[model samples]
Target: MSAEEVHNRISMLRAERGVSRKDLAAALGVHYQTIGYLERGEYSPSLFLALRIAEYFGVPVEVVFSLRPFPRLGSEVVK
Candidate 1:
């Protein structure tokens, strides 16, 4: 099976809001590392957390997360 395609382009949103990680963490009731991980795309949040993040940013969950087809992996695949 292919892995799910995930992208966490949150840095731009953070910058646009002018809020620090610590602040968001507090608002989200998670550790600062959680925010760090999320922003880095190293973590995929649960539905609740995704909703919290979207609410924090005043954006829709669809804006923060999306599903796309995973790229095939093999020599036959095109770049």
Candidate 2:
């Protein structure tokens, strides 16, 4: 079976929190380049890493990661 792509908001969260990739990587005990790979969807994080990322952002895992694509910002609001 083909592997499903895991979607994430790591980049957005990092931006909102004023975090640098190197800083985040250091916090997560991963290589800085790994953060770039994750942001680019070129690599998928392990479950443990995903949970750690969510914990770092003080948000639920679902908020940070999703199997389906997340809606654009403010797209849920009705005009």
Candidate 3:
């Protein structure tokens, strides 16, 4: 079976938290470059790693990773 592309908000979350890729990588026990690869959508993380990332950010896993593309902020229309 083919693997699907996993979408994530790592970069946006990092920026919002003022966390650096290196710091996040270290916290996740992964190479710093891996964080960059994830942010750029060049690599898909394992479920374990995904959970760890969410834990690091103190959010639910769905908040960090999604099967569908997340909508951009301010893209929603109010009724």
TM-score per prediction, in order, is 0.76, 0.92, 0.92
Pairs clashing within candidate 3 = none
Position 37, candidate 3: lDDT: 98
Model 2 weakest lDDT span, ten residues long: 1-10
Give the clashing residue pairs of candidate 1, or none. none
User: Which residue ranges in model 2 land beyond 4 Å of their true spot?
Assistant: none
Off by over 4 Å in 3: 1-3, 77-79
In the range 1-79, model 3's lDDT, one tens digit per residue, is 2268899999999999999999999999999999999999999999999999999999999999988889988778641
lDDT of 2 by residue, 1-79 (tens): 1267998999999999999999999999999999999998889899999999999999999999988888999987954
Candidate 2 lDDT score relative to the true structure: 0.94
Question: lDDT for every model?
Answer: 0.77, 0.94, 0.94
Error of 1 at 73 (Å): 27
